[model samples]
Target: MLFLKLLGAALTLAGTARLGRLLGGRYASRTREIGRWRTALSILATELGFGALVLTQALERMALAVGGHPGGVARRAVALLHEGESSAAAAWRQAVTEASPRCSLTPEDEATLLDLGVYLGATDQEDQLRHLKLAEERMVGSERVARGEQAQRERLLGTLGWITGVLIVLMLL
Candidate 1:
């Protein structure tokens, strides 16, 4: 009975630690890049293949569709972007939430994304690149913060699990 209890504790601690660390890393990695409707779309599409489509990806798909359409794709993309700020904002918010599980994004990150949507295909190449840079900057900052917290969070969970199991064992005794 004692052996079973010890084994259970050990497995629980190990699993908890591994899961925390893995999720943190995944979260950090998922936030490595941000904007430019097409680049964002391309990355999101790739993410889709992995079943991780986020709000940003949805924007990307919309941009790609509009840009890739055979007849006056550029003109159509422009019209959609011009549809209204609220329309773009809603989509941007959705992307951020969709990716919430895998990436912890700040309001600033969301704002930057919203800005990216506004310019989207509506802007010239240089402008698009600028928005992309802004998104990338935000993501990079977020990733750094996430990476710093990841180890600490993992350790905390692991230590707590260990301590909890030990306490349980003592109580049973």
Candidate 2:
């Protein structure tokens, strides 16, 4: 019976630890993704400053960062953008909205991204840069909040795991 109690405690602690790590990993991944998007937007804006490309082409290239690859939803949005101006905007908004739930971003981040889609290629080089900057700022804020929450959650889970384990073992006794 003592052995069984010990085993149960250990398993409980292990599971909590695993869950905490998973949560932390998720936050880290989100930060990386958001950072990547910011970098890509900065790059695009810089390119635009030198010489403007077609809006569709700019979006397609930006998709590489947003989608994480050529086959990403953002890239597909770029294809839709090529069809018509309104369709392209709708596609961008849809992509952002759909993607929000899949990651650790706030609704504000999604809204900022959607707004960015409205101005990405529709504006002049300076305005595009401004919009991209706004988006980057929003992403940075979101990443900070996410990282803080992740750290707190990890700590809480870790503490809870040990506490639960101890309680379980005591109860078994």
- Give the winner by lDDT: 2
Q: What digit string (tens of lDDT, one per residue) describes model 1 on residues 1-173?
A: 98997787777667655665565465444344332223544443344334444434444454555432211222333344456554544444444445444434556655656566575544555565566566656666666666566556656655665666566556655
Report residue 78 deviation for candidate 2 (angstroms): 1.0
Clashes of each: 2, 0
Where in model 2 is the C-alpha error above 4 Å? 65-73, 83-86
Instruction: Please give the range of 10 consecutive residues that has the lowest summed lDDT in model 2.
Output: 64-73
| Candidate 1 weakest ten by summed lDDT | 68-77
Model 2 gets an lDDT of 0.68
For 61-88, candidate 2 gives per-residue lDDT tens digits of 6665455621254666775666666565
Q: Relative to the unseen true structure, what is the C-alpha lDDT of residue 26 in candidate 2, on a scale of 0 to 100?
A: 70
Look at candidate 1 and tell me the lDDT of residue 170.
Answer: 65
Against the hidden true structure, what lDDT does model 1 obtain?
0.51
What would the TM-scores of all predictions be?
Answer: 0.51, 0.78
* Model 1 lDDT at residue 17: 58
Clashes of 1: 2
